[model samples]
Target: MGFLGAPVVGVDELVDRIDPRPVLESRTIHEGYVFDLVSETADLGEAGTVRREFLRHPGAVAILALDDEERLVVVQQYRHPVGAFDWEIPAGLLDVAGEPPQLAAARELGEEADLRAEQWDVLVDYWTTPGGNDEAIRVFLARGLSPVPEAERHEREDEELGMPTVWATLDNVQEAVLSGRLHNPSTCIGVLAACAARDRGWATLRPADAPWPEHPRRR
Candidate 1:
């Protein structure tokens, strides 16, 4: 928590103070290809019962692949909802049931960047738009990268077919983040986390397989 500022309380005290609201009822409002819209009624005690709607996402993993030159691998693709070409790290949904998140990260790395990494670390985990979506994303820092063998390369399709892949220096990426040029949530978070981890001499990173008990997909 050094980079995040002072801690308010110890883990035990924080856990003891938690009084989670109980969900009285929940139902899927719409079933989509990647996610389902859910409406939930919860007992908020003093606030009384309330109803809310949100997307129940399957979760996702993003990879921040760094080459020996310290350039970060990125992709530019058009996102329909945003109606713009966004720069983002390699990422994909964790839709494969029972598959480990780290493995999903590796798959995205290969599919999006055509790269494989020998070293990996957990950079950060975050919920994208927590107020309306349960889309949790775990970002990984990958080093010692090499191109994926041509024999096992993944075929790009749809939006990925013409997407351009590029490498940017860490400093440039950080500048983009601060200058508001980068709007993709996972990419921005990953870049900032990687910079912090590097500044702290890489002590902030966790093992690639570290337990993520808070990730909703795991539960």
Candidate 2:
């Protein structure tokens, strides 16, 4: 073993504690919200120690805003968990196994933003609270939008609760982060990445919605 308990494994070793035991388990007790406790188990001696824990659903996806005019997209909704409705971006969990993150992004844009992108690029993929959950958000940068009729879109059970899409400049979003208005990491990172990707000119995709009037700068 290496340090305290770190193993001297090869650089190619992809998994930690190859024999990791399922420490505990559970199941989803509700809906519309994220996290469905899947199962649980126990870990024995040697490779590690004993611990209690629960399994969880894999995760979902989040997409930053796009104005179809090379601008950023943001959405607003009342997050009871956060206790206030604020402008954020489009995001949701994947319900189907083997579903593509890009497809999910397209669907969310249509359902939440009433827009669709002509092109979608993989932005970044990361786990959210891996220490306690298996949830991961695969973010994508969408460009080139086309509006889908509201009738064709299936509003999420909670969307009727009022999730609406708003668009803004990336610089504005960066400012919101600094001022403490935006705290969602997925939104922050996705916007930052999209900003950089814009300069790098990843790829141009068509947009579904007509560009909205620019909101006055946040003082």
Top candidate when judged by lDDT against the true structure: 1
Candidate closest to the true structure, highest TM-score:
1
Instruction: For candidate 2, write residues 68-136 as lDDT tens digits.
Output: 466677777777777877676787767766565567777777777777777666676666775676666
Q: How would you encode candidate 1's per-residue C-alpha lDDT over 15-38 as one tens digit per residue?
A: 422244799999999999999999
| Shift of residue 197 alpha carbon in model 2, Å | 3.0
lDDT of each: 0.91, 0.64
RMSD of every candidate to native, in Å, equals 3.9, 9.9
Q: Model 2, residue 92: what's the lDDT?
A: 74
What is the Cα-based TM-score of model 2? 0.69
